[model samples]
Each structure stands twice: as structure tokens, then as C-alpha cells.
Target: MSAAILFDGPKDAPFTLVLAHGAGAPMDSPFMAAVAQGLGARGRRVARFEFPYMVERRASGRKKPPDRQPVLLECWRAIVAELGGGSGLVIGGKSMGGRMASLVADECGVRGLVCLGYPFHPPGKPEKLRTAHLETLRTPALIVQGERDSFGGRADVEGYALSPAIRFTWMTDGDHGFRPRKASGLTEADNLAAAIEAVDAFLAACGG
Candidate 1:
């Protein structure tokens, strides 16, 4: 069985958003919690789960590298199955977790995808883009990214080809996790609220 942590919101809500954590944080990290709670407050049911590495960290109190691609993918699939096969569900996450979800979304046939901050490429290595799969994805997707995210900022992603099914929502002067700089006049809370609204709308459009 895959190890996971779930955050349950309104049980009778029309839809559920299954969220995963980023590369370095647990499922209940401040960012994930904020997003989950924000969505829940808007009357959307949200479920958050941790990857295996994060679960290990919780048990042993030691940091570890993320699991390999196959392991991550398998974990997502297993989680989906355990969560009742994605009916009325939108699946996604932050950064690396979001990327993994995008890869398997079509196969899982979820209602839609909502990526809080997609890692289009590795930090400082634009040549190694992780967007080939995304370019041809058929699943409906909403990618909320920081305008200045090092993984793939607005300037960087504008040149790349992405699928028509994917919609991009840029957060002003924000970084990997959508935290904006003070000079930009945008607060992290404001950006996060915008992201939650965008997600709520996207899921609504998908008939969730």
C-alpha cells in the first residue's frame, strides 16, 4: 500500500481536489495547507497526500531525496485507485508533485488538473525542460505559475509550445511557490487567493 495523508473537507461537496506536496515538503506543508483550506472555504472538498519519501521523513526525522519517476507515478495511481478512481476529482500539486500528476492525469482520466506551480524545467537548466509530455496532453488543465519562477518563469515559458487544453495563470513577480517579492506590491496571500479562485473556476468549467 502507498503511504499517504489526507485532508478531508465537506464530505458532500460536488467535487474533490487531490493534492500532493512538492519535492521538499510534506503534504501538510504551510503552502499546501493554505491552498487546501482556501479551496475548502470556497466549498470545495480537498484531499492532500504525501509522497513516500515525505512519509519516511515523518517517521525517522531525516530528510531524503524524492522517489524516482516510476515510484512517484505508481504512488499517484495507487492513491487515485484508493480514492475511488477520480470521479468528480481534480488532481494536481505543487512543483515536482504537479509535474508527476500531469504525466498520469490522462491515464487516470480525472475530471481535470490544477497545478499550483509547475516546474517546466530544472532550476538553472532550461535546456532540460520537463514539458514534452505537457505539450501534447489531452486532459484539461489549469497551471497557476509564478511569473518569476526559476523552474519556468513567464518569459521562459512563453516561448515553449504547450497544449491548447492547458490554461496558464501567472502570479505577478512570484517565485516557485507563488510568493511574490515586496517590490512587486503583491502579497503571497493575495496570490494564493487568486490561485484558489482560478482553480475553483477551472474545476467548475470542467463540470466538477
Candidate 2:
């Protein structure tokens, strides 16, 4: 993990956000770009980095799968170290990236955490939950999920005994990436704006 590729906001901004990409996308994927830019516009410095596998994929132009969980965890740790040991930083990302960050947040002692479109389980495999650690997680965090996400919808997540420190904001009629159905009368931009606002408020509440 070299120094992260940054999409800087204001130089003297009060907050720093460190983000990693999901399993299937690069750090600069459209989804990542939107969140980074949206948040950056609101006055926070944003840093985006890739895991080992994604970096390789970028160089080779090959569609490689995600790294093993341990490697991803180590990658998050490295990013945390690079970003000044996390004291005044918020750590999170999209889906798998966000999940990996959650695995290290308590250990890193980050100021906050945010997850966009968290995948609670593999598609159509509801029983294979990836939420055990989230149950007892102590790091203040927000999971902004789409209402109809194939991975984890509102109904599915409502049954879990998640940590008290965790909060959720459901994007109406949204799929995994938060694109709502046309009939729902809400555009993707609407959801994106709502999600950004939710994250902004979450960061503010963290007082970082």
C-alpha cells in the first residue's frame, strides 16, 4: 500500500476521510468517485486507496477477484497507518471496503466509520451472514444501505442484533448501488444526495 491517491477537498479542512474500494471496483470507480467528490465538496479531505489485488488489476487491466479476508484486513491496517494512525480520521468505504474497515476500526481507534451499500450477505444467501463482529462493534459507524438491496434489505437487517453504536439510513427503493426503480419516483441523484447528507450528519455527530 503506497501512500493513498487523494481527491483533496480544502487543505485546512477539519476532517479527513480515508476510503477503500469495494471488491469489484477500483478506488476511482463511478460509485467511489461520487461519494468522494460529494463529501469533499462538503469540506473534508478524502483519500482513496486500493488493496493489493485491485492495484494489480489496474496495472494489468484484468478483472481479478478480491483478495483473501486477511489480506484485505492487513490492507486496511496499512492505510490506517499511512493516514496518521487514525486519531482524527474517519475510515470506511463502499461494501467490501467498508466491511474491511469495520474489521480494523476499533483496533485503529479511528474517529468514525461509514459504509455505503454494505453487503450483509452474499446475494440470495441470507443465512451466510457477515455480521457477527458488527454485533458487538464499538466504533461509532453508519451503514447507508439501499432499501431493496439484494445483499441486505431493510427487513433482513432489522432482525439482526447489531451494535448500539451502529446506525442505518435506508435509501428508498434502492438496489445495491442505490439506484431506485423508476416507478419509485426518486432518481439516483436524490438517493446519492440523501446518502451524502446522512454521512455528513454522521461525521458531524462523531465530533471529529
Candidate 3:
């Protein structure tokens, strides 16, 4: 797609994290920026890139739908190739980005996978699940999700037959973006920090 990658942290870091944006946000959205910068400050190299559609939107100044699934998957494969076939790399991102990463993690043979706020299913449409692949995923992965995310809340996800290799860090009263409500007495920033901490720990566990 001819998209340029934006990098963070030390150039000589042993392991690198490559992250992509969700369906609706660009790579540099506030959430993405915060996560990349947080990890970078902690001595983790992070890379961010946009999909073909997002790149088009940037050039045309118009919002567009995400590229088709095959296109997105190919883009991810290309990224992994560009980064030297994913050795010593963790691949993941916000939502769709993370989901896509999960699909390719095993194929790429990446060291680990991380999903910031996974979209378990479409909001308010629990029947339209998107987790068939997750049930048998072999790659070790971590998914940070909110307890009450409409996409896939704790009640729903706990019942799914996900792989034992997949672990979770559940946030209190979080939404799709990991933002907690006012009455919950938890700020979005709080959840974000927690997510970052969880990711750092997970990366360490993965030998990054």
C-alpha cells in the first residue's frame, strides 16, 4: 500500500512491537499514540502504520470504510515481511488491528500478540461473533478488555471456547476503547495506563 511506518523507542532495541489502528481511527489516534509512546519510554521499540484505506483518506481528506478483510490481511503480511519475518516481534493493535494480528500471528511465527481492546463481536449484535479462529489459536497472546464492553463483555467472553494460550487483563467498567464511565470513578487515562502496564508485563513474559 506504500504506507510509511512511524517508529518509536530505541532503534537498537532487541524486540519490536508493530501496531496498527482500528477500523475508524488512523494510526496516530490519541489511544494509539499514548500506547506507542508509553512502550517506547519503557525501552520497547514500537512501529505504527496505516492500511491502504486510511492512507487514501489521509491523502484525500475524506473518511472511508476499512479495506476488505483480504486486503487488510495482505497488508499485515507485507508488514511482517518488511520487518524481517517477525522474529523477536510482537504484533497487535487497538481493536480490528489486534484482531487482524491474531489471525496472522501463528502464520508469521511472531514471538507474541497483544490486543488493546478487542471487539469480540459487533456492538449489540452478540450473535454476529467473530471468534471462530480464536478458539484454536496456537500463538501465545494477551487481550486487554473492559468488563462491560458492549462488543464482548466479561459475561459473554468467559463462555467462549478460546484457546488456553490466550490470557486476559480485564479492566473495570470499560467500553470498546477501554474508556470507563464517570460514575465508575475510573478515568479513561487510568484504564489506559493499566493497559500499558499489562502489555509491558506480557511482553516480558514473552521474552521480549
Candidate 4:
């Protein structure tokens, strides 16, 4: 019942990190690739998978909207069950992928959750916040988000009622994709390294 997976790093690693792709991209997107490689090189097993719609899109070579929320959550449920009920595991991904993981992390009984570029709401619509569950989320979560992400910037998140168990690593001046403007004196690569480092530290803290 598991989605096909693209895996990286040692199979025998202490923990496995499962990542899903964003709404508009595949599992091998440059951003996902970089983070998976970076984290894998640091000695964690990483796996990436596509939702059914994305899989079909690949086969048909056509653009399609994301699956409905129920379908998306079911995909995560299957993925979690495939990965040994999420024990000693971390689940997350870029944007929508990450958001879906957050929705299932506590339910899966995972050791931890990691969300890269979590969307607080649809872009240009700040009134529709997607953070109600986050306020009470457990599962020792870490969110690595762009400081100025169009979806949910640092300023916007500061006023939200997120859980105390969740910590954040903000990529300074980075956009939704974690790319910084040249004037910020920080490259996209730099922010990626920071994000990877934060995840590594978090995993170590979790005894992985």
C-alpha cells in the first residue's frame, strides 16, 4: 500500500526521514534533492515519494491539481504504515508536502516531524490561516521556514498560537522556496546548509 519511494543514504541508518514533494514539483526537485543529499551525507536515511496525482501526471505528462485533502492524508497514512508505524522516524517535505506531514505526524506516533516552508495559508490570502492544528500539535516538531516567505513570513507567524513543542529555524530574507535576495549577503546554498544543520541537531537531540 506504500507509494513508490526514491531513497538516499545508508539503509541501516538509525532513523529514516520521509519527504514528500511540493504541490507543483516532483520529489526530485532541486530544493528537495539538495536537502536530501545534505541530510543523507550527514548519515540519515532519506526517502521521497510522490502522491498519486503527481505519479499520474508524470505518466500522462499533463498538469493536474493536487488531490483533495482526504486523499492526501490517506497517502500519508499509507506511507507511515509502510515505514513501520513511524517509530524513530521523521516525516516532512517542502510546502504542501510538509503541511500534509504535519497533519499526520501526531496521528502516526512518529518520533518527530520536520516541515520545510510550511504554508500558513494560500498566498495573497492571509485571512485563511492553516494553523489551527499546529497550535496543539505534539510529536516534537521543527519547522524550517523562510523568514519572508510569501505564504507565512516570520512576522505573520509570530502572532499565531503554535505549540510550544514546535521550534523554528528561519532562513533570513528567503522566499517561499528558501531563496534569498542577493542583497541579503546569503546564498540559497547557505540557507540550505543552515536548514540541514538544524535538522541534524534536532535528530541528534531525539537520540537518532
Best candidate (score: lDDT): 3
- Score every model by TM-score: 0.97, 0.97, 0.97, 0.97
State the lDDT of candidate 1 residue by residue for 134-192, as single tens digits.
88999999999999999999999989999999999999899998999998888999899
* Candidate number with the higher lDDT (1 or 4): 4
Tens-digit lDDT track for model 4 on 51-155? 999999988999999999999999999988887878968999999999999999999988888899999989899999999999899889999999999999999
Off by over 4 Å in 4: none
Rank ordering of all candidates by TM-score, starting from the highest: 3, 4, 2, 1
Extract clashing residue pairs from model 4: none
Give the winner by TM-score: 1 or 4: 4
Candidate models: Cα lDDT each? 0.89, 0.89, 0.92, 0.91
- Deviating ranges (above 4 Å) for candidate 2: none
- Candidate 4, lDDT over the whole model: 0.91
Q: Cα deviation in Å at residue 157, candidate 4?
A: 0.6
Runs in model 3 lying further than 4 Å from the true structure: none
Candidate number with the higher lDDT (1 or 2)? 2
